[model samples]
Target: MSTTFWIIIAGAIATYLTRIGGHLVISRFDNIHPRVEAGLNAVPAAVLTTLVAPELLNAGPAEWAALVVTAVVSLRGGLMAMFLAGAAVLILARQFVG
Candidate 1:
């Protein structure tokens, strides 16, 4: 196998190990502290920010329009709705802007 293939396999294995390891450790505790739970709940938002912040630096008008639509939809809808709204706006805006 190529080096790239091995690297992908290694990364997948590492990710799986970390996920399972966390589950195992948490399951050992009967009750989770509120602070720990709050931190866990915040992980998704933090991850999303990390992913989106870099993209903003190079975003075009189409991307900005999609982001605004996504944020608006997220305030009133679920994850699926937010994703679909953003995608629809991105496609439509790109057609005209690009």
Candidate 2:
């Protein structure tokens, strides 16, 4: 109906095509190369770094406390535990720090 709507539709179609194309290509291969598999495994860490690095530049006490707790939890717990601990610390710290 509008330019923005058309742009959103185009983007959705593009995203779907890329996802399907990747799946099709991967399915055709009998086995993946170890290097490629390692690269794929590293994607999550790279993406997380990209997301968190910028936030650290503008973080406050609450954010720092959450990050510290998250790091500590990550060293000895599962992902869910780390996330929950970080979120709880952030919320509780904000209540007092703000």
**Per-prediction TM-score:** 0.75, 0.70
- Model 2 misplaced stretches (Cα beyond 4 Å): 1-22
Model 1: residues >4 Å from true position, as ranges?
Answer: 29-38
Error in Å for residue 59 of model 2? 1.0
What lDDT is obtained when candidate 1 is compared to the true structure?
0.95
User: How well is each residue in 17-67 modelled by candidate 1, as lDDT tens digits?
Assistant: 988987889889999999999999999899989999999999999999999
Backbone clash count for every predicted candidate, in the order shown: 0, 0
Q: TM-score winner among the candidates? A: 1
- Residue pairs with clashing backbones, model 2: none
Report the C-alpha lDDT of model 2 over 1-98, residue by residue, as the tens digit: 99999999999999899789878888899999999999988988999899999999999999999999999999999999999999999999999987
Worst 10 residues of 2 by lDDT: 18-27
